[model samples]
Target: MRICFPVSQEKGWESPVFGHFGSAPAFVIVDTDSGQLEEVTNGDLHHAHGMCQPLKALGGRQVDGVAVGGIGMGALMKLQAQGITVYRAVEGTVKDNLAMLKEGKLPVFSSDWTCAGHGHAGGCAHR
Candidate 1:
């Protein structure tokens, strides 16, 4: 499966997962089955609150899922509309979140989990 993680930098698997999906500095796309990884800059990183276009920030790459600490309801709804599942990411590196996902430890993101506002400027508080 190809899982996309919003990260603070371009550290590949070692990159720390950013707290907010929309404002992340970058993203890491990992092919869990093949262990292939690619880093992409978040083009829409500076957009206004509630204006996150996930696919655009991801450079239009199709992903099976998105893992992040938190997301706004608008962005979350957009992702879900695209048939992409969102998972609650742990407070660790991309590798750690990936492991948690493999173990079914990551919670599926729902409307209840979305941030009330645009989410923190740095990210969002983990639930």
Candidate 2:
């Protein structure tokens, strides 16, 4: 399985994950089979629209899921429309998140949004 995680910096396990899907600084993608990481650096996002630059740049990556702290309604809908499974409420560093995913302990999305302590700058809330 391919998994993407939105994070602040490449801190250790204690570092918490942040940033929304549409407008994240970078995304750490893990290839479950090989445990290799694909780092995607987003240079520009402007909070332009729901289909932000980063997300659009991720086209056809064949990711099975994405782990993030929060996301907006527009981004969520766009990702869902592409059949990409979203898993939110994930806190911890990039490495910890990967381990959690490997252990099947990763938090998957529910009908109710989970967006606490993610610094919801957009203020959309409950992303």
Candidate 3:
């Protein structure tokens, strides 16, 4: 399975996971089976509230899941509609979250788990 992580930097697996999905600077996509990594800049990173276009950030790559510290309801719903599962990120680097995901220790994010608004106030533990 492949997992996507919203990261603050483009340091591959070493990058720390960004707090909010819509405003993350970049995304790290990792292939669990092959251990391959891809980094892409977030083209739609700046947008109004409830207007995140996650597919644009994906840059045409397909991912099985997204591991994020926080996501708004609209973005979360959009991702689910695209068949992408959302997972709560572990409070660390991309590598740490990936390990937790592989171990099935991270919780799957649902609509109720979405942030009340932008800026990671009510949803995520690590911001």
| Most accurate candidate by lDDT | 1
lDDT for every model? 0.89, 0.63, 0.86
TM-score of each: 0.92, 0.72, 0.90
Instruction: Tell me which residue pairs clash in candidate 1.
Output: 20-123
Highest-scoring model, TM-score: 1
lDDT of 2: 0.63
Question: Per-residue lDDT tens digits of candidate 3, residues 1-127?
Answer: 8899999999987999988898888999999999999999998977877788999878878999999988988889989999999998866999999989889999999676677764345334322
Better of 1 and 3 by lDDT: 1
Q: In candidate 1, what are the lDDT values of residues 8-89, reduced to their tens digit? A: 8898889999888988999999998899999999988888877889999999999999999889888999999999999999
Question: Could you tell me the lDDT of residue 90 within candidate 1?
Answer: 80
Model 2 C-alpha lDDT per residue in residues 7-71, reported as the tens digit of each score: 66654343356656655666677788986777665544455554454455464466778887677
Error of 3 at 85 (Å): 0.4
Which regions of candidate 2 are displaced past 4 Å? 10-16, 49-54, 57-60, 114-124
Can you tell me which runs of candidate 1 are displaced by over 4 Å?
A: 118-127
